[model samples]
Target: MSIKSASLTIVTPNLADTRKFYEEHFNARPVFDCGWYVVLRLTTPYQEPEICLMSPQEGMQAFTGGAFLNLLVEDADELHSELTEAGLTPMMPLEDHPWGDRGFGLLDPSGVIVYCYHPIAPSAGFEEYIIEQS
Candidate 1:
């Protein structure tokens, strides 16, 4: 069976702050918001690939954030500058990786690692692992 869509939902006490972080830094728009829960999307013309932020419900555990979110963007350096100018600091500075990524990491309000990257050619040993699409 083909998968239609998939999304990751994060439960946090800082739901609003997290939502705002994504909205301001990632160009995310709220597709759904009910104060305690919010659905955000970075793309305007498509659905799916959403990030959901929710306040922990009664009897539920809130996320303390050992999560990582990877965002593949067109220009990592430009986005890095923009985020820095906007007063957000990167947890990991922008750099090229042997694994074919030029990326940086930032910690969100809830302590999640939001890594933003762009594609780059992998170093020799790493190139063999990349699967080319048919």
Candidate 2:
């Protein structure tokens, strides 16, 4: 089956900080920003995996996990470096995936994992990359 949209709900002790981090690095801006809570989308010139940032009221049942939310990039090393230089510590470094992708993961305030990546031998023709895998 083909995959479509993916989403994750997040929480932070300080929504402002988490929001700013995403905005600064991924160039994501909130479609709805209430200062304490927001819903963001990546701005022009950047293709993205529709992501939303949610910061609920204290004690709300917000989703939390160590699993990853991935973002595809052409160059993981460069992007990872830029993030590190800007003072964001990557929880993982560029590494080869057994499934034929190069990538890394980052941990956010809510412990949500974010991955930046590029598929190895990435297909320009959709057919090639759509092969079924176990």
Model 2 lDDT, residue 77, Cα: 84
Tens-place lDDT digits, model 1, residues 1-134: 99887788999999889998999998898889898889998873444478999999999998886889988887999999999999999999999999899999999988889999988888999988888831
TM-score of each: 0.92, 0.74
Lowest summed lDDT across 10 adjacent residues in model 1 is found at: 41-50
Best by lDDT: 1
- In order, the Cα lDDT scores of the candidates are 0.89, 0.72
Which ranges in model 1 have alpha carbons more than 4 Å from their true place? 44-48
Residue 131 in candidate 1 has what lDDT?
88
TM-score of 1: 0.92
Global lDDT of model 1: 0.89
Model 2, which residues run further than 4 Å from truth?
1-7, 44-49, 122-134
Give the alpha carbon lDDT tens digit for every residue of 1-134 in model 2. 99776655576655666677778888887677766667778664655444566666767866556567778787888898898888888788788765667888888666777899887754455446656752
